[model samples]
Target chain A: MAPVTMIEAIREALDEEMQRDPAVVLIGEDIGVYGGAFKATEGLLAKYGWERVIDTPISETAIIGAAVGMSYQGLRPVAEMQFMDFIACCFNQMVNFVAKSHYRWGGPVPMVVRGPCGGGVHGGPFHSQNPEMWFVHTPGLKVVCPSTAYDAKGLLKSAIRDNNPVLCLEHKFLYRRVKEELPAEDYTVPIGKLAVRRTGRDLTIATYGAMTLHTLEAAEELAMEGIEAEVLDLRTLAPLDREGILESVRRTHKLLVVHEDVKTGGVAGEIAATVNEQAFEELDGPVLRVTSLDAPVPFSPPLEEHFLPQVADVTRAARELARY
Target chain B: MELPEMKYPLSREQLLDLYYFMRLTRELDEQLVRLFRQNKVVGGLYSSIGQEATSVGTAYTLEKRDWMAPMIRNVGGLLVKGFRPRDILMQYMARSGSPTGGKDGTSHFGDLQERHVVSPISMLGDLIPVMTGVAMGGRYLGQKLVTMTWIGDGGTSTGAFHEGMNLAAAQRAPFVCVVENNQWAYSTPVARQVPLHDLAERARAYGIASYVVDGNDVVAVYQTTKEAVERARRGEGPALVESKTMRMKGHAQHDAAVYVPPEMFEYWKARDPIARYETWLTERKVWDKKTKAEIERRIERELKEELEFAENSPLPEPEVAERGVYCEGCHTIEARWERPIEQLQPPKASVQAAWTVSDFGGTNGGGAAAKAHAPEAAEETKPAAVAAKAAAVSTRGANGGTKRSARAAARPKRRR
Candidate 1:
C-alpha cells in the first residue's frame, strides 16, 4: 500500500465512518458540491447524497448550534469549519452549549468539529491559526492534533465514535506535506495517548501538529552534533498525555516545548508549568519554549515566517538546552 | 383597534385548560417573586406576569414531537410543555432532584428527550440558530416536526438572530420564530432596540412570511402561532410571528421599574393578558366566577405542595460538584495531572528505533553526516534560498500582468 496524505486519510476516515454508521453526516459551507475549501471532504457528497452531505449557509453559529441539536437527537454529525480560525464565531455555542450540555443535562453531544488549522500556509490572520489552547482551556471538549496520516485517520474515527464534543485540528501545512501508509483494517488511536515520534537521552522536544515536523527536523540536526534530542508528539491536548510527558522529562532531564500559537497563553506555557511542578527534580535546565510571537498571524510571507516557529528555532533552542 | 368579537377555534374544555395554565404560570411567577423577597429563591426572579398569553398560546400549539426553545421569561411555555410546578420549584431551590442535577439552579432547565425543550442559554438570540438546526435536522429525518423558538425585541438586533433567520429561510427549514415584543428588554424600551414600529416586518428581509397579533389576547396569539406552526410543518419554510404585548413587571424582581412612565404603565396594565382572557372566557359562558375561584384554589393547593417538596429537598452533596462536568463513562477529568512521574514505564523500543533516519527511508541525512554539518550554514542558507524563491514568485504574481494581479487589484479595501 502507498502512503496517503493527511487530507486523504481524513477523507477516508469520514467515508468509512459514515458507511459504518448511518447516523454520521457532514455539514458545512461548500462541503457538498464544492467538496470543501481544501477538498478534505471530496467525494463524500457523491457517495452520501444531499441529506447526509448538507451544504449549509455561512453561519458558524447555526452550523455548531444545529450540530448540537442533531446530537441531542442521537445523530453523530461531523461539522467542518473550512478554517478553524472562523471557529471563534461559534465560540459561544461551543463553550456555552455544546461543551456543557452533557455536564448540565446529561445529554452527550456526539459531534466532531474538524477543520484545517496552523500558520505555515500563509493564509493570513483569518485563515491561518492555532487556536487549540482556547478549546483546551475549555472544559468538556477533547482536542486532537495529529501529525501523521495514521494518527489523523485513527484519532478522527475515535473522535466520531466518542459520545462527547471533540475538536479535530488538522494542520493545513501537513494536509498534503505529511504522509504515511495506513493499514487497510480499521483502527482507532486512543484519545489520551501521546506518540513518541523520536527518543533520546540528552533532551526532549515536546510538540504536536505542524510543529512536530520542525521538531523532528531539529532533532535530526541536533543528532549530528552528538545531541540526542527526543521528540514527543502530544496528539491530544485537553486530556494531555501526562505520563508520556513526565516519562520523556525523566529520561532526557531537559524539556523544550514548541508550538505555532502565540507565546503568552499557548500550550507550551502549560507544559512548562506541568514539568516545573511534577517533574522539576529530573530537569537539569530551565523549561524553555519555541513558539510564535505574541501577535496575529501576518499575511506577508516574511512576517508570517518570523511570527511562526521554524526548524532553526527549534534546533537553536535544543542546542542551548542540551548544553545545560 | 377594537377588541374583535372573533370566534374561538378551540373547544370549551381546551379554552378552560388554556385559562388554567395561564393562571398557574402567573401564580408561579408571583410565588417566585415572594420567595425572592423572602431570600428563599437563589436567583433573581424573571416573572411572566402580563406575558402569559403569548407563551401559553404559542406553546399550546406545539405537538409532543415538536420542540420549543424558550427564553428566561417563558415559565408559561415551560408549564404548557409538560414541566411540572414541582420540577420548576425544585430547579429554583437548586435541589439534587432538579433536571440540571443542581448544576444550573436558575431558569436553565429542560427535558430534551421527554418534551423536546431546549434549555435556555443566558445569551439572547443564541437559541434561534439552535432551534433552526433542530428544525433542519427534523426535516432531514422526514419527521413532521416544527421547532418554535422565542426571542425578545432587543434580541432581534443580534447577529445570531439574523444568521438563524437567514439560514432557516434559505434552507426552507421547518421553524417558527416567535418574537415576544413585550415593550422592554431589561429596561431598554422597544423604541431604543429597533427603529421600525413592527418587528415582524424584519422577517421580510429573509423573504419569510410574517404576522403581528395582539399578544395580550390569548386567542389571537394561539390563532397566529397555529397558522405559523402549520405552515412550517407543511415545509412551506420559516415564519416570524411578532406578538405585541407589555411586561407588566420590571425585567426581574430586583428592578423597581422606575424608568417606566406612569401613563405607559397604566395603559398596558389595563390590557393585562390574564384579566382580558378571563373577560373573553366569561363572555362566552365557558368560564364563571365559581370556576375561576375553584381553579385558583386548586392552583394554590398545588403550589403549597410543590413549595414544600422544594424546600424539603436535600442540597447536593459536596462531591457532586466533581461529577457532571462530562458524561458518565467518558474520560476522567485530569485534575492537576496528579500521576506520579516515577511510576510510568520507560520509553518503548519501537519509538526509540523509529528515531533513526533509516526508518524514514534516509531521504534526509543520517546521524553522523547531520552532526558534521555546520549549524549556522545549514540554518541560515536554506531558508534564505526558500524565502527568495517564494518572494520572486509572489512578486511575479503581483506585477507580471497575470490573472492573480487582476483579482488582487480589483479586490475592495477591507474595513479595519
Candidate 2:
C-alpha cells in the first residue's frame, strides 16, 4: 500500500466513477488538455473524450447552470468550481437552482462540485475562502469536506454518484500534504455519516475537513497528560451527525466542538446548539469550542497559524474540559 | 437553400405550414389572454403578441429532432415543437399534469425526451451556454442536430449569452442564437440598453456572422431562421439573428403600461402581427374570412376542451411530495467497505494532477443575475404545514421558479 495524497485519492475516485458509468461526465474550466489548474483531471479527457470530459468557459454561473441543466436531462455531471472562491460567481445558481432543484422541482441534480477551498498557502481572501457555512445554511444542498485521503476518495465517489447536488470542499492545504493508500477496488462512502478519529471517555471533540487531522494530533498529546479525549470527524457538515455527536457526548459527558471556520455561525455553533437541545441532560460542563477567530483568514503564515486553532489549543481546551 | 445549383423553389404548402404554426401561436395567445380575463388561468403573462414572427419564424425552420431552448415568451415555439397545448395550459394554470408538475411558472417550457426542448430558466440570457451544451451534446452523440436558443434584447446583456456564443463559435457547434428584440424589456426600450445600432454587430465581436430582420413579419422571421438553421445543419456553426418587433401587451398581469409611449403603441398596433399575417395571406388569396373563421373556431373549440381538461385534472398527491427530489432509483449502490481503525493508513500520492475543465462541444462580463425567493423568512426557513398558510412560497423552486426560502413553505401538504 502506498501513501497517496488527498488529490490523488479524489482523482482515483473520479477515475473509478468514469470507468463504472458512461453517464458520469466531468465539466469545468481548464479540465481538458491542461488537466486542471491543479491538474486533478489529468488523463480524464483522453479516456472519456469530448462529451464526458468537458472544459467549460470561465463563467462559473454557466458551468453550474449547464451542469444543472445536464443533470436534469439525466446525465450524472460532476461540475468542478475551478476554485472554491470562484463559487461566488455561481452563488445564485448553486444556492437558488442547484440546492433547491429537489426541494423545488422534485428533480435530482445528482452532481459533484469539487474545488480547491480553504486557506494556508497565501492564496489570499479572493482565492481562498471557507464557504461551507453558506451551503450549511442552505437546506437542499449536502456539503462534504474531507480531512483525510481515505475520506476524500470515499466521499467524492459518493458525491459524484449522488442524485443530489453535493458540494465537496477539498482543502488546498491537504491536496499534497494528506496521503493514504486508497482501497484497490472501487468504493463509496455514505453522505451524512461520521467517523470517530480517536475515542476517549472524559471529553468529546467534534470537527471536520482539514481540522479533523489537526484535532486528532491534538487528542494524541492530550492523552500524554492522562486526559482522555474523543475526536469525532463530522464528515458531512450540513446533515451534522447529531447521533454520533450526542452519543460521543453522552460517553464523555463533556463536549467540545471545533472547526477551522470563524467562530460565529460556524458549524460548531450548530453542534453546540443541538448538544444543548438533545443531550444537555448528560452535560457535566459547558461545551467548549476551538475555532478560527471571528476574522478573515490572514495572509501571513504566523497570523494564519494563530488564526486557525492548533494542536496545543485543542489539547489545552480538552484539558480544561477534563478538569471541569 | 440554393445549394449552389438548386432545382425548384420552396412550394406554397411549405410556406403554408410556416403560416400554420405561426397561426397556432396567435390563436393560443388570443385564447390564453381571454382565459386570464375570465379568471380561468392562475397568472397573467406577456403573450408572444407582436413577436409571433420570431417564435414561429425560427421554429418552422427546425426539424422535429433539432433542439430548441426557447425564452419564456416562446410558447408558440414550444407548442410548434410539439409541446401539448393542454400541457402548456395546465402549466399556465399551475395544474398538476404540467411537465413541471404544477410548480414552475411559464418561463421555459421544455422536455428532454420530447421535442428536445431544454427546461427553461428565467435569468434572461443565462441559458445561452446551456443551449450551446445541448448542441455540443447533439454533436458528441454524432446526431448532426442543431440546438437553437431564443433570446430577447434584455437577455443580450447577460454573461451566459456571451459565453455560450463564444463557445459555440470556438467549437463550431451547430446552433442558432435568435435575438428577439421586441423593443421592450418590461419598461426600458432597446435604445435605452444597446447602442451598437444592431445586435447583429455584437456577433462580429466573436467572429460569428449574424442577420437582422423585422420580427413583426413572420415571413421574414421564418425565412431568415430557416437560413440559419440550414447553415448550422450544414456544419457551418452558429448564427445570431436579431428580430426587431414590438410587445403588444403589458409585461404581465396588473401592468399599468404607463411606460409605453402613445405613438409607439399606435405604430406597432397598426402592424399587429396576427392581423398583418392574416392580411398578407388573404391578399394573396391563400385564405379568406370564412377560412380564417373556421381556423379560429377550431382553435377556440380545442382551447375550450384543453382548459376544461386542465381545470378538472387532479392535482398531484400531497403525500408524494418528496418524490422527484432526486431521480427515481438513480442511486448507485455504494460498494461499502469497512476495516477496523487499526487498518487505517495515509494515502500514497503526495499530490496529483487537477481535473481539467473539459470543453464540452462548443457551443462573460457580469452584472450579477438573480434569485428564487421564499415569500417570507420564517415561512421560508420553517415551512407551515397548512398549504394555505404556506401557499405563497410553496413552490420548491424547480424550473427556476420563485423560490420559497421559508423551510416550512415547501413541505408537502401533511396528512391529517
Candidate 3:
C-alpha cells in the first residue's frame, strides 16, 4: 500500500464502507457535487450516485436528524458537519435524540457525525474548535480523534460498523500534514482503545488529535536532553481508557495531558481527574495539563500559537513533571 | 347533530372502527388521568381529549408496513397502530414489562421491527428530519413505505421542522407530515408562534404540496392524509397536511392551563371530536343505539382488564437500569428489505456522472433548485394489511356489525 494523507485515509474508509455495505450513505452540505469543503468526499458523489452521496441543505439539524432516522431503517449513514463547530446547530438532535435513543427506547442509532476540528490553520473560533468534549460529556456517544492516517482510516471504519453513535473528530491541521502507508487488507482500529505512540520512562505525555504530533515532537526534544517522555495517544476520549493511562503513569511515575482545546471544561481536566481518582497512589507528581488558554481560538498566527499549546509548551510541562 | 353525507368511500364497518378507536383513545386518556391522580403514573400525563380524531383518522389511513412517530398527545394514533392499552398503561407506570423496560415514561416509546413506530423526542420538531430519514432510508432499502410524524403549532417554529421538511421535499422523500395545528403550543398560542395563520403555508416554501383540513372532522383528516400518503407512495415527494384542532387539555397534567380563556374551552367543548363522531355515526345510521352500547361496553371491559394487568405488572429491577446503555450484543437492528437486495449492488446502483450545472445557475447551491436524482423507481407492492382491510370491509353483509359485536362479546382479549 502507498502512503496516504489523513483526508485520503478518511475518504478511503468511507468509500470502502459504502462498497462493502449497501446500507452505508453519506450526507452533508456541498458533499455531493462540490466534493466537501475539505474534499474529504471529492469523488464519492460520482462513484456512489446522488442517492447515496446526498447533498443536504445547510441544515445541521436535518443532516444529523436524517442520519439518525436512516440508522433506524438499518442504513449506516456517515454525516459530516462541514465544520464541527456548526454541530451546535444540531445539539438537541445529537444530545437529546441520537444520544438518548438507545437508553430511552432500546433503539440503536448506528451513525457517525464526523468533521474536521482543532486549530492551526487560523480558522478563527467557528471553523477551528476541539469540540469532542461536547459529545464526550454526553452518554451513549462514542468519541474518537485519530492523530495519524492509520488510526484515521481504521478508526473511521470501526466507527461506521459500531452499533452505536460515534463522533469522529478529524483535525484539519493533520489532514494533509500527516501521511502514512496503510495495510492493503481491510482492518479496523477498535473504539475505546488508546495507542502508545512512543516508549519512554521518565514521564508520560498523553495526547490525541493533532496534539499528538506536538507531544511526540516534545518527546524527541526531551529525549536529547536525557528526559525520556513516553507518548500515549488518548485516541478514544469518552471511554477514557483508564487502564492504559494508569499503566503508562505507573511506569513513568509522572503524567502530563496535552490538548488544543481551551483549559476550562476541556478533556484534559477529565484525564487529570481520572488519574487522580483511579491512580492516585501510582503517581509521584500532580498530573499537569498543557492546554490552550481559557479563551476562544484567535485568528492571528502569533495569537493562535500562544493560545494553543505548542511543542515548547508540552516540553516545558513534561520537563517540570519529570523533575517532580 | 346532522352528519354530512358520506364524502369518503368508507364502509359502515370501517366507519364503526373509526368511532371505536376515537372512543378508545378518549377512554384510555380518562384512565391515564385517573392513574395520574392516583399517583400511579411515573410522569406527567398528556390528555388528547379534544384531538382524538386527528390521530385516529391519519393513522387509520396508514398500512401496517408504514411508519409513524406520535407526539405526547397523539395516543389515539398509537392505539390505531396496534399498541394495546396495557402497553400505554405499563409505559406510564414505568412497569418492568413496558415498551422501554421502564427506561422511559409517557409516549416516548416506539417499536421499530413490528409496528414500525419511531419514538418521539422531547425536543419538539426533531422527529420531522428523523422521519424524513426513515422515509428516504426505506426507499434506499427497497421498501415502499411512507413515514409519518406529527408536530404542534409551537414545534413548527423550531429550526428542525423547517430543515427536515426542506430535506424531505428536496429528496422527494416518501414522507407525510401531519401538523396538528392544535391552536396552542404549551402556553403559547399559534398567533404568537408564527406570522402565518395556516402552518401548511410553511411547507409551500419548500415546494411541497400542503393542505388545510378540519382536524375535528375525522373523515376530512382521513381523506387528506390518505391523499398525502398516496402521493408520497407514488414518488410525488413529501406533502404536509395541516389539521387544525385545539389542545383540549393543558400541555401536560402538571399545568392547569390558567392562561386559556374560559370562552376557548367552551368553544372547543361544543366541537369535541369523539362527541361529534358519535353524533355523526348515529345520524348516518352507521351505528344504532344497541351497536353503540355494545361498542362502549366492549371498550370499558377491555380497558378494565388492561388497567388491571398494568396495575399488577411489577417495577423493573434496580439492576435493570444499569444495563442497555449501549447496544452491546443485546439488540440487533436489520431493515426488512421488501424489494430485491441485489438492486443496491454495483452495476444496478451506478449513477450518471454528469453534473446539471443549469439547475444552480443563479444561486450558490443553497436554493432548492435541483431536485435531480429522485429515488430510482422500484416495482410497487401494495401493502398486504391495507388490501386485507379493504377486502374485509367490502365483504361484510348487513348483519356484519352485529356479527363483529357478537364475536367481541364471545372472544377473550389476549393479554400482552
Candidate 4:
C-alpha cells in the first residue's frame, strides 16, 4: 500500500505488534526518545511510552540476558544488539542461555532479536559485518538475514510472533538503500522457508540477507550473457531450506552459493556439503561460492570493495557454472 | 562480625532440616555409590557427601521465594532447596518425571516458575549470570527477594562468576553469591582456582561485600548467610560469602582422593566442622547423647523416605519431551492466556483444535500449506516483526510480573 524504506516498515511492524500484543516489549539501547541508532524504532517511545519502549544501557549482555528472563516470564521481548559485530560481547548469553533455552530446559524462548548486521557502506569491519554464521552454528537459535523491505517487515513480524527465539539480521546497507511497496495491513513471513526471488535454469544462486540483493543484481546482469540464474534467498539460515536449495540445484544442474560472510565456514560450505550428501546426483558443475575473503573487511572504500563479494563476483561464479 | 564467630546457635528445627537433608545427601551419596557399583547412576557422582552442612545451612534459611542455583557437587543444596529426594533420584538417572524429566543428568536441575531452585550445572559458574538476572528481577519488581547461588572454590575460575557479581554490584541487585569453598576443587584445591588466600577477597573486584565462614559449622554458615541476605535485601548489591570447609569425601563416588596428601587429609578430618559443632552444642548442654542419637536416627528415616520415593517414581513419557524447552507457557500472561495467534484468530477455533494442534503453526504444515511460506508473498522478518501489533495496554502488570517498559526499542534502524 505504501512504498516504504526497510527502516519504516520495521518500525511499523514493531509499532503494530506492540499495539496488538501487550506482552510484546522492546529492549535495546537508545530505542526510546533517542529512537534507534538507525531510527527503526522512531516514534515508538512517544507512541507506546517508555515503559513499553525502553532504552537500556549499553550492555548487550544485559539486553540479551534480560530478554531471556523476560521471555521466561512470558513477555515477548524483542532485544536488539545495536551492531551485529558487537554480538561477540554477549556470545554466551545468546549461544548458552537464549539459544539453548528450549533444548536445555524444554522451554520456548518466544523472543525475537533484530539488529542491523552486514556491511556494504564504509562502516568498516567493526560496524559492517554479516556475522550470521556464528548464530547459525548454534542449534536453538533461528537466524534470519533479510535483504528486502518486504521480507524485512514480514519476517520481523513473524520472528516476533514465532514460539521460538529468532535472530533477524537486517543488513545495515539495505535499511535505507532498499525500498519497496509493503502491504499496508498486518502480515507475517514464516521463518525457515526460503524464497525463490528470480527464476532461471542455467545455474542456482543460493544466498541471503544483503547478498540476496547482490545475487539478484548478478542474475539480471548474467541474463545479458545468456545465463539464467535461479536465485534462492535463504532468508532463514539455521533451518536451511535444503529442499528449495536442492530443487534449484536439480533444475539448473549447477549451484553457485553467495554470501557476505567470509568464504571459509560460511553458510555456503554447509549448503554445498548438504547438496553433496543429499542431492549429489543433481549436479553438472562443481558447487562454487563467491564470498568475502578470509581477511577482515577493510576500512578503506576501494579495498573494502575488493574484500567483500560484489555483483561481479556472483556473475563470474554463475558464468563459470553456465559454461560448465 | 567477629573472625569465625557464631551468632545464634542453630536451633532444633534448623538443625533437623540440616541433619535430615544431610542424611538425605548421605543416603543419596551411598545410594549413588551402590548405583555406581550396580551401574545404575552413570558417570562418577559429584556428591555433597561430606560437605552437607555447607549446602543445608545456606539453603534452609532461604524463604520459599528465594531463588537458588546449586553447584554440581551440591546434591544437598538440591535436596534442601525443596527438591524431593525422589526428584533427585529421578534426576540422577535422567528420567522424564524428574524435575528435568530425566532430560538432565544428576546435576542440571531446574523448575523456574516454582520457588526458584535451579539445578546445579557445570559450565562451572555460568549460573551467576542467571542468578544476577534473577536479582535484577527482584530489583525491577521491587521485591524483598534475594537470589542465592552456590558455587565451588573451583567455580571462581569461571568468567560467569565475575560477570554475575559485577553486574549485580553495579546494579545493586539483591543477591547472595555463596562460594562453598570446601578446601579442594576436584583435588586441585583453592591454590588452583585462585592464588588469593580467600575466595571472599575476590569480592573487592566486584565492589560487593564479602564474608568468610566455617562452612562445616552450620551456625556460622547460617549466621554468615543471614548477614549476606540482609545486606542484599538492603539493596547493597551482592555478597561473596566464602564458607571455608573441608571435603569429607573425594570429588565424587570413585575418587580415592589419591591427589589428597595423607597429612593434609588427616589435618582436615581432625577439624571436621560437623563433629566440632556437635560437640560444641553438647558441651553447652543444649543436646545430650540420647538426643543426638535420636536426631541422627530421624534423619536416617527421612533419607529412607526420599530415596524410596525417588526410586519408585515413574519415568517421564516420551511424547512431551519437547515441552518446557523454551516455555510455551510464556504465552500465558493473562486470565484466559491465549497464544498470540489465538487472541487474533477466532476464539471458537482455538477451543476446537485445543487438543490436537499446538497454539503456534502446526509442526507438520508444509511451507505451502503454512500461513507464512505458502507460494504467496515472501514473509517479512521482524523475528517476524508482527505488523499486526496487539492492543497496547491490556494486563500490562499483574501476577508476580514486572513491567520495565511498554515498548522497549528491540532493534536498530536498518542502515539503508
TM-score of 2: 0.82
**Model 1 steric clash pairs:** A224-B371
DockQ of each: 0.15, 0.12, 0.71, 0.07
Per-residue lDDT over B1-416 for candidate 1, one digit per residue giving the tens place of the 0 to 100 score = 12334332687778888999999999988788777878877776777788999999999999998998788878899889998887788777778878877888666877766798888788888888888877866665556889998999989999889888887876767898899988898889989879987787787677666667778878877866787787678666678888888888888887888998989878888888899888887777787789889899999999999888888888778788878676657532111212232221121101111112222434333322221111011221122332232222111111123322100111111111
Q: Lowest summed lDDT over 10 consecutive residues: which window, candidate 1 chain B?
A: B405-414
**Residue B226, candidate 3: C-alpha displacement in angstroms:** 0.7
**Stretches of model 4 off by over 4 angstroms after superposition:** A1-3, A15-63, A123-125, A249-253, A280-284, B1-11, B94-97, B138-144, B191-195, B234-236, B253-263, B280-416
**RMSD to true structure for each model, in Å:** 17.4, 14.2, 8.2, 14.3
lDDT of 1 by residue, A1-324 (tens): 899999999999998998776668788988876789999888776666656677777999988988887776667889999999999999999999888877876767889999999887789999998889889999899999999999999999999988889999999999999888999999999998999999898998899999999899889988999999899999999889988899999988999999988999998898899998999999899999999999999999999999999999999998898888
Fraction of true contacts kept, per model? Answer: 0.37, 0.18, 0.71, 0.12
What is the lDDT, from 0 to 100, of the residue B21 in candidate 3? Answer: 94
Chain B TM-score of model 3, please?
Answer: 0.86
**Order of models, best DockQ first:** 3, 1, 2, 4
State the lDDT of candidate 4 residue by residue for B221-274, as single tens digits.
676677677656755456777777677678777788888878976776766656
Q: What CAPRI-style quality would you assign to candidate 4? A: incorrect
Chain B TM-score (each prediction, in order): 0.77, 0.75, 0.86, 0.73
User: What are the lDDT scores of the predictions, listed in order?
Assistant: 0.80, 0.72, 0.85, 0.70
Interface RMSD, in order shown: 15.1, 10.6, 1.4, 12.6
TM-score for all predictions?
0.86, 0.82, 0.92, 0.78
Interface RMSD of 1: 15.1
Q: By the lDDT metric, which is better: model 2 or model 3?
A: 3
Give the candidates in order of lDDT, highest first: 3, 1, 2, 4
